[model samples]
Target: MDSLTADDFFALDLPRHAQLIDGTLIVPEPQGNFHSVSPYVLAQGLRRTAPGRLRVRRQMCVVIGARDVPEPDLVVVNASADGGPCLMSYAARDVLLAVEVVSPDSEERAQDTKPRKYAAAGIRHYWLVTMDENNRPAVHTYELDPHTGSYAPTGIHHDRLKLAVPFTIDIDLTEIDRL
Candidate 1:
């Protein structure tokens, strides 16, 4: 198919899981239980104490430009704008954080390509969560550099993910359940 405009993509009545990346529509591979629930766990954790302005959403479609609308595993955006939206999509500029949980189905996209798009779109923070052999979520975080238009590695989080951006929180990875 030819490259599609945002309107053309949305008007296709594509499934919710469909995403437009660089003008191509791709459907993410099927998710497992862990992939599905991790978002809920993260959302639950973030919303527990998030400030009113920030809302945590899973599989939130983001408009990265006219031809891309990739949905990150989780997104943190300003709730106060657009009457406190908790809906279909948000502009990339409104995104404060974007998280992608790595699964075998789409490892490279999560660890590589998606982060590039997120940073290029000027999203402030991006995280890639991958599971180890023993079933631990190892988080690699990134921060966008305005000067270079790229992302700089902040840290790789293991047992705990302590953050001061997109709100402050110290998450105990072991405490989060995934089945």
Candidate 2:
């Protein structure tokens, strides 16, 4: 295995999805605009409604453990800790939620890679947003069951989804279609 750590991965200027798993570097394909925007909308919504309960960030590197650091599309962390640096370096317990906007070229990465990684890292909540051909967003929310190391589907939102913390708000899916 490669001797790369999360610190080593962070030091690089590479563009694709570069993560460190078990001290090995993994570079997945790059993301597209459609993949990027959906998460942006969600992040903005979280910031506006639940400023105290949730922290919305984009492309923030989270260190799930010593050997793994993956930068998710949007990370919903504890609101009190918003200005902190490198999420990947934080303990898995600090991550309140993790969201991934699916890239057309990296469907498998979203469907398989992220779920396994996040579940292993002990993230409590995870979301996967899929964009239709017209670029509309469909949201799937998962809550991790630590006992099984599996995520149970909590809800699916097509047009709008209700967010639970910081404040109550609805994220309109129609905006995703515009992206």
Best by lDDT: 1
lDDT of candidates 1 onward, in order: 0.81, 0.74
TM-score: model 2 vs. ground truth: 0.82
Query: What is candidate 2's local distance difference test score?
Result: 0.74
Per-candidate RMSD, Å: 1.9, 2.8
1-179, model 1: which lDDT tens digit per residue? 89987778878878768888889998887898767766666677778767888888888789998988998999888885434444578899889999999888678888888888888899999888888565777888889999898899989887677888757867777665533
Error of 2 at 35 (Å): 1.1
Assess the local accuracy of residue 126 in candidate 1 as a C-alpha lDDT between 0 and 100.
89
